[model samples]
Target: MELDILAEKENVICEMVSNLYRTKSNDDSEIFTSIYNQYKSIHLQYSELSKNNLEALKRGLFIQWYQKTEPNFLSGISDLEQDAEKQIVNNLFTVINTKQVDSELIWMLNYYNSWDWVFLNYENFRRFDTNLVNEANNRLPENIDKKLMLKRGQMGKYWLSLIKYGSTE
Candidate 1:
């Protein structure tokens, strides 16, 4: 019974994580926010597991989730601090520096480098007091391509996240 419960919790966490990536890929901020909150709640439930399982499972989340088959736009989903985990962070830094990223991640890195564009409002322009970016009536730009811009506008957020969490936030 205990094993079954533990397995179920693991499955729930896995599904929640998949949902997070899906929402992020789709650029669905509303749904992503909802899933993010729910994941936090479900992860907290892992404490009910026996033994040192919670810490072990956290390691798995970082290893399988952040360091694997797909691009990890969700890099900071956990916190990686131990010496062994630092190796993973170093690997990512090397990949970024050497331009040797996996093909799947290349597009995301390109989009992020593009820095994307913004949709501002009258209040925003007034706040910045710059006529540089005029209001677009709170509408997306005509050339907006969400399909090609999944992580475009998140540079600062991710940069700070990588700095603080070291790629497993």
Candidate 2:
């Protein structure tokens, strides 16, 4: 299929994921499972496209979804960070960046990179607020990897700042 058509389809999938997140209920495992299955199907369909086209489609869809949903969706509570929908979207982004697209493509998307866009946009980003970060730092386990924790905390803070300040930079 053409890149435009594939992107449109991916946009639909993003909308579905967004709706699912918005309407999530307690004990939503079954709904999440079904969404995961649907994502797998969409992934398979995109696998048929040429690598460049697939990358373009993913990038286009990412921008489209961001523009369409960022205002309300970015700050809303959702299990998106741990959800299969995020996994699938991130997988596509990884594939496109590592396999299909070039440096320029990376530069373009790097402003609102996929990792920050998906993982950091979760409600949990608030946990890394400065007041809470110090408390979290004090509670860290002795045997735990402090470096990893610090890096994650920094990422969380960075993402939170971006959202709170409304600047992708």
Top lDDT model? 2
- How big is the positional error of residue 30 in model 1, measured in Å on the Cα after superposition? 2.4
Instruction: Mark the 10 consecutive residues where model 1 has the least summed lDDT.
Output: 118-127
**Per-residue lDDT of candidate 2, residues 23-97 (tens digit):** 865775665566545444444444433233545344433433343345423322122223433443455455554
In lDDT terms, how accurate is model 1? 0.35
Per-residue accuracy of model 1 over 1-169 as CA lDDT, tens digit each: 4434433444454456566766656665565455444434333333222123423233232332332333433532332223334333344344445555443344333332232221121122212112221232222222323322222212223233334323322
Listed in order, each prediction's TM-score against the native is 0.25, 0.34
Candidate 2 off by > 4 Å:
52-103, 108-169
Error of 2 at 128 (Å): 30
Off by over 4 Å in 1: 2-27, 50-169
Sequence-dependent TM-score of model 1:
0.25
lDDT of 1 at 165: 28
